[model samples]
Target: MGGLAWLTPRKRSATARSVLAGEAAAEAARKTEHEHESEFPTPGDTRAAAFFDLDNTVMQGAALFHFGRGLYKRRFFRTRDLTRFAWQQACFRIAGSENPEHMEDVRSSALSIVKGHRVAELMRIGEEIYDEYMADRIWPGTRALAQAHLDAGQKVWLVTAAPVETATIIARRLGLTGALGTVAESVDGVYTGRLVGEPLHGPAKAEAVRALAAAEDLDLDRCAAYSDSANDIPMLSLVGYPYAINPDNRLRVHARENGWRLRDYRTGRKAARVGIPAAAGVGAVAGGTVALVALQRRRR
Candidate 1:
């Protein structure tokens, strides 16, 4: 009876009517199955999304390294461990996070050190660390770009390999939609010293976005994505509008080859290096914790 109500009298023969109704039902069932498989709504969502990679893409540098410094200052780990972390962060700065080995090492060390730490205490530390080390490091231009997406009513998400707690704080501070990061397994509200899965990077990052899209009914074809490193190419490729921010050599070449938009915030380094004042020094934190912790090795 769904579409059969529009039948003309001449075409309403009992046999024809049954066949027409069956065809209509079959089409409807096919559509519903497709929607379920793709996780798309029947009419599809009108809202779009913008996914931003953290670290060099949004902030100026490696975020976890900064948090490591806060933990080190609190005596969370030994001076030797901090030194090792600092060296890894140095590589991240110079090599543009192309080394999955360094990333996994940092992820392992960070999670391991947090074992047995109370979740509430870490959250508090995260808040304090951001205010002191991360708040000012955010690039004004990139921040405004995020705001533009928010203004347009698009969901703005931060995708990073850092812990979910850390990512949530950053997104909240910037009024972003939310964030997806590596999850550290916990029991009884304390760290278990292990990851629930692999760190979100490369193809893993794209998978995470697709999972989010399915959960939120987002349309990737209408979405936009931004990142600064070549390592994030998989993630950028997942969307229709892909922008390369402060892209490295590999990323620049790739972007150009694909005709992707590029934004270079590195020029701000000039004003930052001019010895202007506090305002200009904000750029320091881009490499702040990552660089300083290397020199801080002798503290112990």
Candidate 2:
């Protein structure tokens, strides 16, 4: 009892005050959480849009590769076609598709086979291809983000370099607003196998969004865009909110410099399994050494 001098009235008062302050903070936190429960964009009903870049953003891998598998199974081409495409796919996955040469090469090769086929046939095959391959590959996080935008009453569109048929199938399956993709000309409902314009890539993607915005009366300042590749910087820049999901190297730097938000959905195990050697964007950033390594592993 003689050593109890420290337990004065002041000390007891301070302890009670600390307990009350903690309770007050907890109550404030609960109120904030309740207020944000419906915090997604739709409550204001803005005339905004959500643009998503397909390939590696929504799906884990190349959309064209899965489309090629669908085409192959339907005998739209031969075994040699698959071999050639596989080689191209390996180079593409390793080197990345932002390179103009790579994009042109891929476009030329794909268009050559799609020529002279019936539009209906390709559309049917696209449905099957998406169900069998693409459906499972959809990233849950990206999907949720898109759905959030849709719930907010903003338009959600998938932008890709894939064929219109395949892109449409994916959009319809996912219940998105629409999709913009490379257009292959068809004559009398049969594939003429020629492109109406360039592949919707790089700057072209931005242009497409602009066209859509003009047509749909959307305010770009309220819009949002998401992508994985540095190639989509043009498109991302067109929006108010840009998310670099699973961003590549060049994109990572750009996002950081511009103070853009980023989310990484690619787990370490998948990165290791893919033999990426470094971050997904390393090949695009450091040197072709990483690209060479990735290509070699894919070959195996």
lDDT of 2 at 259: 94
**Candidate 1: misplaced stretches above 4 Å?**
1-46, 268-300
Q: Could you estimate the TM-score for every candidate?
A: 0.74, 0.74
- Number of clashes in every candidate structure? 0, 3
TM-score of structure candidate 1: 0.74
Q: How high is the lDDT of residue 81 in model 2?
A: 78
RMSD of each: 17.3, 22.3
Local accuracy of candidate 1 as per-residue lDDT tens digits, 1-300: 555567776544543433333233223223333444333222322347778999987897788889999999999999999998899888877765447788778888998899999888998999999998899888776776776565555667788878877887787788776677766777899999976545666656776777677656788877878898788898899898788876777887899899987665655553333222234223433433322342234223
lDDT of 2 at 90: 78
Cα lDDT for residue 71, model 2?
A: 80
Mind sharing the TM-score for model 2? 0.74
The 10-residue segment of model 1 with minimum total lDDT is: 37-46
